[model samples]
Target: MVATTGRGRQGRGRQKIEMKPIQKETARQVCFSKRCAGVFKKASELSVLCGAEIAVLAFSPSSKPFSYGHPSVESILERFFGSSADAAPATPPRHPPAAVLIQALGRQEKELQERLEAGKRRKAALEESLRGPQWGPVGDLLGAWRS
Candidate 1:
């Protein structure tokens, strides 16, 4: 079996091991403990190096909770989960002027009505055309108007 080490500088001192089923379980527990400690250590190092607050939480294989924070966990928790007083309440979006909206609606309605009437006329013309010589006289009249 191949062994794989953890990533990052925090994992520098740790070594990977290969083992069987029972040994794998033991190795897993040991790795988890070491990695968890490394994670907390890195968090602490980051907070100190950057002068930034940090919080971390993890649960072990046994379901026991572990946590770490710089400058108090509650402060970080409050900053994370608490709402700021400076935040503005969300407001409904404003619309265009009522006059402009009404005008646009009226223009759209007129265009749609014109299109409907033109479609009806086109359908009637097609039906007449399909009826053969019944539309001959109308066609002749329109041909004369075109001339």
Candidate 2:
């Protein structure tokens, strides 16, 4: 039965797009977001259907982690690996105060600036010492200065 045409498309022309690497970074990120959501949804469905304890952890191209876990990852890991893996660092709250963060950052920046200036002074002293014998020997000089 060589009756030509009609592969159930109502005689419409269909263009087959070859899967290729996305050129633009933004476009790739958007595509990754869409596809990551789709995959997570599928994983959720599969876990529900098969009644299986499952986990899927993925990293985006930018190295950000995205994960899906059924019946809690902590419980599942405890059942298999051990409870030791549950020693996670304390997480920040859902929202933090901007003023508090800014103040903390300011304090850190000031401390770092002071340290940097101290380091620069130490470096200059070392360089000056290296320039001539008048600055004297270099045996534990920095340590001596610290004391």
User: What would the TM-scores of all predictions be?
Assistant: 0.42, 0.42
Candidate 1 lDDT over 97-119, as tens digits, reads: 89999999999999999999999
Name the runs in model 2 displaced over 4 angstroms.
1-17, 78-147
Give the clashing residue pairs of candidate 2, or none. Answer: none
For candidate 1, the lDDT comes to 0.78
**Per-residue C-alpha lDDT of model 2 across residues 61-83, encoded as one tens digit per residue:** 79999888776665555556755
**All candidates' lDDT scores?**
0.78, 0.76
